[model samples]
Target: MSYPICHEEIIEDRDVTAQLDPRGDVAVLVPAAGAGVRLGPGRPKALRLLGGEPLLVHAVRRLAAAASVHTVVVAAPAADLVAVRELLAPVAPVTVVAGGVQRQASVAAALAAVPAGPEIVLVHDAARALTPPGLVESVAAAVRSGHDAVIPVLPVVDTIKEIGVGERVLGTVDRSALRAVQTPQGFRRGVLTTAHAAATDPLTDDAGLVEKLGVPVVCVPGSEHALKITRPFDLALAEHLLAMGR
Candidate 1:
């Protein structure tokens, strides 16, 4: 007969204080070069305030806090590199590199900067400042399990529809098969290098380029806490969330 296992029993069986994986020697790249054009006039997107600090700081801190991450590479503009270094230099094993106009370019720049390639390379947007610590651990664990690429995704809870340029409803989209992709996308170093090289131009996300390589990227459950701080309203909400320690 099968017996039920309690939480404490499971931990004891695993022979650990926590159920975290032993492999965490992952490299994390935080792309922070985008000029806040979409976010309005001045300042870069990474410098945008969220929860009383630059959004980039929060992103860096989260990755630095992860036991699985051995190094963090921040790609940003040369002009901002000095200031960013001053802000995050205390975070050990951190390096800042000049980025490019496109997201792919920035990633390439960061990749070039890493001396020793890690088993898993996680690419995350500095805009996603509030990513949960547990979520970060989950993606790293998934990659360590032999998956080439792992992305955190959220199932669409609201009914979705395809719309045209003129705001006309084009058609109803199948929400069942759709999930809104979130960041902290983990990839094997070799897999990402080949995929990024194959991609000649800018695409929406790294997964797009990876998908073109015919390798499927596995998705893990994500949380609302990992929301990307895109606009002014998002900044306000992030502050609220941070205050409540959510």
Candidate 2:
């Protein structure tokens, strides 16, 4: 497949949710191995408390509920592998394994554990604790519909600026051309494996690795509830969002 390197045109999403039935065909990988230095230093980001429970607990629980998803694999910190397994046992049946130091390595570890049956694989950040099952299904649906790769995105509302040294504003960035990418990023299982095999330099997201191979990635609508829990304020906001039944 020839991937377009150009920006993808936005396709508005409908209100109706997909009735995804990817049973035994979709595998989800959650890379929960980050130190999360921004969320205030007590525990690994995924293990940190959110609404009186670990963030990983909320993330895995949601993915497991999706009808399309059959397997959920977690990559935990080397020290917390056993603890993470115990924490998630009651919420959902997940496979917990020791994770590598970097995010990409952790993803590769979880990817290797995914069974042979699933043709589609999704890489979701455990930090997106409140991601709705509908959004998960949407990405998976796109892949099942023959897209090689897909990701969820929200339009950027705030004005963006480019800064230079000495704190001087260099130029204003066009926000209209930009969309904030979110996860549960979906891919063909073979494409994901190939991307990992070819990766050399470090990257923040798996889609970028696929992009390096010149594959075009499509974008789907994302929910505000899928906000990543990064800073102290973000955690507090997530707590508030959860309280509102979001």
Candidate 3:
């Protein structure tokens, strides 16, 4: 079973100085430079307010709490590189670099900044700001356990349907074999590097690139707290969840 950290725990964790081992086995890359058009006009998605703090701050606090994570590399908007560094300095030790126009580019940039230590690398979304430390450790543990690639997933709870050209439903699809994928996707450093280098078309997630190489991606149970904040409703929902102290 997966245990998720509450909002209170996250706030407390941020106050303590992170003592992550420099030689730890995992490096986390957060691609946080997206414009978040779906979320309406405001600061970049990662920099948006979450409980009075930027979403990036909340996300990094959780990442720092994970024992297996040694290094954190964030790809921030090019114009906000310095600002992002300053914002995160008080929260945790992080390397901030200028992000590219696209999410894949941001991940590639952050991945390039990773040092030589960690053999396992995780690509996480800054939008999934409330992801727990345990979930981060779990993904890293799965990668450490000999999996070439690993992703956290939740069983799909909504009914599915196949739609036709005119928005007509073709048939109801099976839900039992489907899952909703979550971030903190883990991969062997070399495997991720190679996949990024060979990438041609832009894919939604890094695992897709690995899948093209015929690599098997393993899945572990995911946390509900790891929801991505895209639209205004999502932000509101996150606020409610935090208020409830869940």
Worst 10 residues of 2 by lDDT: 9-18
Separately for all candidates shown, the number of backbone clashes (residues 3 or more apart, or on different chains) is 1, 0, 0
Across 1-246, the per-residue lDDT of candidate 1 in tens digits comes to: 211111111001111214566465889888899996767776899988776688888888877767777888999887988898998877555889999998899999998886674778999999988786667777788788898888887777798888999999999988767777778998889999999889976897887888887888788777677888877778788899889875
Query: What local distance difference test score does each model get?
Result: 0.79, 0.87, 0.86
Tens-digit lDDT track of model 3 for 1-246: 222211111112121223423337889999999999999999999999989999999999988878888999999999999999999999999999999999999999999999888899999999999887878877787788798998888777899999999999999999877777889999999999999999999999999888888788888878888999999999999999778764
In terms of lDDT, which candidate is strongest? 2
- Write the residue-wise lDDT of candidate 2 on 100-212 in tens digits: 89999999999999877999999999999988888888888888999899988888899998999998999999987788888999999999999999999979999989998
TM-score of every model versus the real structure: 0.89, 0.93, 0.90
Q: Report the number of the highest-TM-score candidate.
A: 2
Off by over 4 Å in 1: 1-18
Ranked candidates, highest lDDT first: 2, 3, 1
The parts of candidate 2 lying over 4 Å away from their true place are 1-18
Clashes in model 1: which pairs?
24-68
